[model samples]
Each structure stands twice: as C-alpha cells, then as structure tokens.
Target: MQSIKLRIGINHCLTDNNDLRYNGETLSDGFVQHTLWKYANWIPVCLEIETDHIHQTLGCQSEHINDLSKKYLDGFILTSNSPRHDSFRPKVGLSKGGTSASNDMGVFARSLSLKYPALPIEENDRLHDPLIRENFLERIFTSKRWNIAFSNSFTPHALIQFHSSHKFLFMSHSVSLYQEMGRLVARSGLLTLTELKDRYVVLMSSSLKQMATPNKHTNVMQHIMGFLKGLIDADEKKEIVETIDQYRTGQVPWIVPITLLNLHLRKNSAADWVLNQTYLNPYPAELMLRNIV
Candidate 1:
C-alpha cells in the first residue's frame, strides 16, 4: 500500500509546473510535476529537514549530494542546467577560481559521480534523449522497487507476494529471468532469507538492463488476457486483442493496450489479484514512461 518515493536532489530541474499539490488524501505530503511525483516519505529524513532549509553547511554548497549517504537515501538526482554542471567530469573542474571552487555545481557533480559511480546521478540535458531518459527511469525505479518491497521484509511469503505483483513487469524485462525469479521465490524455504534476497537483487539488476521489447510486452498482455477469460464479451475481447496486436506491431505504444486493460478492470471489477498487479499501474500514468518505451 506504500508508494515509492524518490529523494531526488534537483538543483534546477523545476520548470513552470514545479508544484502540483496533492490534497494529502493519499497519506503523506507530496506533489506531482508534469509526469513525476515527489513524496515526503521518499528519503528517510526529508521529514526532519525544514522546507526552507538552504542545505548549505559550512563552506560546502555542494553538500546536498552527500545528504543521500547521511540520510540512508536510495538514490539522488542532480538535474542541473548550468554549463558548469554540464561540462563537468569526475575530476575536472572549471579553470576560473580554480581548486574546484567553494560551491560549484560542477564540483558537486564531479564528486557525486566519482564517489557514487553506481548511483543514479543524471543531468537534465542528457535525459532529453528518449533512450537515456528511459534507461534512467528503469534504473531509478528498479532500485526504488527493491528498496520499497524487499528492504522491509525478507521472508519467503513476502518474497512471493513481491514477485507476484511484479510478475508481468518482470516478464516484459526478460522471460528467462522472470522464470528464474519465480523459481527462486518458490524455493525460498530452501535457502536462507538473506541468500534469497541477495540472489534476487543480483538477478533483478541484470534482468532490467535490456529494455522491454514489443514481443516481450505482447507476451505479458497475452498472459493477462488469459486472466480475463469468460469475463469479456466477444467484441470486447477482439478489441483488446487488436490493441495488443497494434502495440506488438509497433503501430501504437503500450499505453493504448495498458489503458484498455485498466478500463476493463475498472468497469468490471476483475479478480483482486488482477487489479493489484503493479503492471497495471507500475508508476504514474502521467509519467508516460511506457508511452515512450
């Protein structure tokens, strides 16, 4: 029932639509921006810090990047637009006011990249490319998924539920890994909880590397259709099949079929299991990540 909240440190990622207020009806304080959502529960310590807090401590203005480590955050986002941040590499900094300066975004970026090479440290410009943005979202969301689902509970039952919810999404990534994950979850009692969790993490990391292709997505859509058997009328089934076929043939994006599935479930109130699958609402529909993927 908990939403994945990402603690992204954005220097200047905001545009005209920065603050789309959520009426707090959900659970916590958060806002939606374009297609992105920022939750208060994202980072462990965002609640403790004041909204007006400048994050400047002592002489280091680039200190916010380090905040991830201190607060046990899953990841960080450095979406800056300045030339200095854009032109910076791991060790290189601008020449003027040399010595890496006191409070330069470039220096901060360099530090973040060099120190946390494995973390999701991205810039806004590079993310303009569709492919790059897709990859970034995958990595960030996958990492977030691990933290949210498995981080709290490592029992066999918990693992099984986690795998069940992400079943279709995993199939879209790699059918092979999807099968392997099911096997691991099924055999969870055979191994220690820690071992199972470790193996699942390793597989999850590798499984999502390859982008979901049309064929794989078609496989999931087909599988979900099986769940709706006898529930949909003949014409409704044909319409759904046609939409899936369109997505498979690349005539339309996955959004079309996905939206259709959501509507069907909403109107008919299918099985609870079907409705609970994260595949139907992996992230926010506003994100449109699937639309581009």
Candidate 2:
C-alpha cells in the first residue's frame, strides 16, 4: 500500500521565544496555526516570519535557503493581513529598499522559488475559499453569516456572495453559537403537545431512540434545558421552553442556514473528510447532507 504523504506549511511570526499567545502576531494567526498543528501532522515548509528586520536577523542566504527548502519545501503559508502587506507595494515600488516588511515576504518567496523550483507553495487563505468559509460557520452556528473578506490569495465567487448577503463581516464564536441555536428553532418543524413531550422525553433519555433522533428534529432547546435543569436541580426544561418562547426577541440572520451547515460538516477538516469518503463520493456537499433530513 502506498503511504499518503502530506505537505504542511507553517505561516506564523517566528519570535526569538516560541510563545503561542500574547505576542505581536494577530489572534487569528495563533488560532489558525494552533488548530492546524493540533489536527494534522504538517512538516514545516516555509515559515513566513512577519518581521521588518529579516535580512539582518535571519541571515537570508542562498545556501541556507537551499537547505531549508530541500528539507521541507512543499507549500508556503502567508500570515500578515493582505491589505497591510499588499498596500505597501503601491506606496513603495516593488523594490527591496522601500519597506522592510514587503521586502521580507518578497525575499522569502524569491528565495524559495530559486531553491525549490518544483515544490507547490500554498497559503492559509487559499485553503479558506468562500465555500469552505460558509460551510465552516454552517455547522457551528444555527443562524449567522461570515461576510468578512480574508486577506489571502485564494478568492472564489461564492465567498463574495456570502459577504454581500450578510449584515456583519466579523463575529466571535460565542455570538455565532447562540445564533445557531436560534436557527435550530426556526428551521425545526412545529410539534403538537404529545409530539413535543415525546421529543422531550427522547432528548432526556439515554436510549438508542434518543440517539437515533436526527439532529434536525432533536429538540436541542429541550435537551439544553434538561441538561441545565440537572445542574441546578430546578425545572431546567422550563428554561429551555422559556428561551424558545422568547426566540423572537433575539436577532437572527437568514444566512445562518449556510453557517450552521458548514459547522456541522466541519469544513476545516475538508481534506481529511474527503480522504475518508474516497470509496463513497468525492462531493463534499453531498457527503455532508447525507445525514441531514
């Protein structure tokens, strides 16, 4: 059997001390790097160090470049915000002397190309196409849309559609999670008195019937309430009921359908998910919706 080989690249600010948090790098950089390293076995390809003093500190030479590329050149991950980095080109022509930051990335790209001509270079932004972004939010949030434009080389038409349709561009996970719960309510079918009680009982029970309940009609609201009731020894089920009753009070977006779908499907694991379903089908959307009714 042929072993599956993967080329993983790290795009981060390599400081003298390898602190994962509370450094000069953006929070998103830390989050993205942490998630990737935690889930996948990626060999360090090209470390796009975000720094002004790259030439003097890192000692960028042809021999050193060849050594690193020969050892781990599969792809390159660009970290800095796209606008900040791209804007520098206009202010200071595409020369090495104008801006230290722009020059650093240019130098790194050129050196990698010179040393390893055949290796494929990829960035984090390239992996997060618009479809991937929508899919990611879909599973996690019941009702929210991610509209923010990513600062990477990869851009698809679907991503533009998401940005145009949504009200906000950026949102935190906590907010997104609540919005997702709201979506579960809106999208769920109306249940009669007996049906609602039966659904509630199934959600509360640990039997196979409960587990078999499809996520679409699982009555997450009641489940959440039951869980909470157990914690405080109160009528937790009432809390869930009350929350659902007050659902109209909260602001929910129409695009959350996309976000919720993406979240449940786990879009970040697209590559792994694709490999797992090689015998079944290659279409991600089809595989994702297989269980959804």
Candidate 3:
C-alpha cells in the first residue's frame, strides 16, 4: 500500500461548474471520480480560468507549474476543453495571436515536461481505458518511489541495479531501445548518473505513450509476443497467441497476456529480478486489475 496519497494535477475544464466546455455537456468518467479519487489528491489547473474566484475556491488555480514544484506532485492529467462556444469568444493563438499552439494542451504539458523533466504526465481521455489507467497508476507509484528514494542520493551501484530490476518494464515498449539502454548502462559503469536519470525518464515517457494509444498498444503487445517466442515452449507460445487473439477480438482485456508473461518469467530461476518488481502487482489482487481480461 502507498504510504502517501499521490498528488496529481488535472485540467480544470473537466470539473469547473461554469459552461466552459465546447459541447455544453458534463465530462465525466466514473473510474476517475470514484476509484482514482479515492487514491489520489487531485489539484485542478486552468490557464483560462485564472481569474475565476469561484473556480479558485474549488481548488482550481492558474499557477500550476509553480504549485507542482512546491507540492512535489507525482503525476499530471491533461484534459481537453475543446473549443468554447462562439458566445464565449475563445482565445486564439498558435504563436500568441490566440493561435492554436497557445491554446493547446500540449503547450502546458510541454512546459510541465520541461520544468519537471521526469514527471509522469498523461492526457485525461487515455485514462478511461482500464489497461492504460492501470499502467499509469503503476507509473505514478513507481515514479514517486524513484523520486523520493533514489533521485538525489544513491550508492555507486544503486542506479544500475535499479535499471536492471526494471528491465522487464523497459522491454514493454521497444526492444531495440531497451537493448541499447542496457548497453549504455553497462558501458557507463557507475558514472553519468545524470545521463542515466534522463534516459530513464525518457523510457518512462515513451513506454506510456506507446501503451496509451490502441494501435500503438497493439504493436507493443505484438512485440512482447515476439520477444517471448524464443523463451517459451510451443505450448506456451500457442497460449500466448490465443490470449492475444482474444484481446484483439475484444474478448479479453490487455493485461491477461502481460500477466501470463510475468508468470512465465517468474518460473525461471535465472529471472530473480522479475520477482523483485512490485510494479507488476501494484494494486491489491482483489482489485482484479490484471484479471479483468
């Protein structure tokens, strides 16, 4: 269990009482409101509603970047406001003339990335998916652990050991990149701690992006299947193929195959590092996050 509740920044447009959304309808996802809310401390952020006292009182604020630093938030959720109604007279800017870029969520997200280069950031819509949400939840906890425990000070071998322990997760996205990262970790040989941190951050960000989108996530799962082919027997390979087929046909959730892989890996005596990963079982088993499929 987490000793501290994660502080996450959410887009204010999703919660404000005022009719700020372009669709003039409530934007609600029950999982976020009920499940995630129970586990996290949410801080609302809105640049457009900077002056709305009512919204401010509700916890929405304009200066989120500074607040993020001060509070040491664990993650961020960027919800889209779409285009405001014509009556609202929305601000326009791609380069400051109320351009698209100025009003874009990417602008704010990019700023967050630049300032807190290792923060776990995700768009709101992606969190609607159970798989993506579970992955994000794991990342939030893992990142907080890294920041609080190992970021500032560590022994000479701590960073390398940490990287090696997380190699299973690093394999979740690109096999080539994962291999290259392992090579870099080996070659660095106890120096370049800052560079290793930056690489780890990039790995987290890239893996999240890949798994959040359906097509990309499909590719990711396929890659995982490919990687496991040589390691598992013919029977296990067939089972994996069937599980992936079910996933593609909407018969099962995505976590089924991943859990399967984890199970297989755990049986290998040489794979003790896989046993050390708590992220695989991040939430209580009763939550059925992995069993939903």
47-117 per-residue lDDT for model 2 (tens digits): 33345544453464455466665443333444334322222112334556655343334445556555544
Candidate 1 whole-model C-alpha lDDT, 0 to 1: 0.64
Q: Note each model's CA RMSD in angstroms.
A: 8.7, 19.0, 6.6
TM-score of each: 0.66, 0.31, 0.64
Per-residue lDDT tens digits of candidate 1, residues 1-293?
22657655454323323332122111221222434444323332121112244243323534555655665444554433332343332334556866664343454567666665555655555566665566667666656766666665667887788788788888888989989888888888889878998888667656766577789888888898887788889999999999999988889887899899888877887888888887777655556667765
Model 2 TM-score, 2 decimals: 0.31
Ranking by lDDT: 1, 3, 2
Global lDDT of each candidate: 0.64, 0.33, 0.60
Better of 1 and 2 by TM-score: 1
- State the weakest 10-residue window (summed lDDT) of model 1: 21-30
Off-target runs (Cα >4 Å) in candidate 1 are 1-4, 9-67, 78-123, 131-135, 150-152
* Residue 271 in model 3: lDDT: 46
| Predicted candidate 3 versus true structure: per-residue lDDT over 1-293, tens digit per residue | 55567788776665545535434455655566766776678787654433333344333323556667877778877664433111111246567565465243344555676687667766667667667776777678767666666746864377677666565555554556667767766766555767766776676566544443334445555654554545788998788778877776777776776677667766543245555555355555544555553
The parts of candidate 2 lying over 4 Å away from their true place are 1-5, 12-23, 26-31, 45-52, 61-64, 81-105, 131-293
- Window of ten residues with lowest summed lDDT in model 2: 139-148
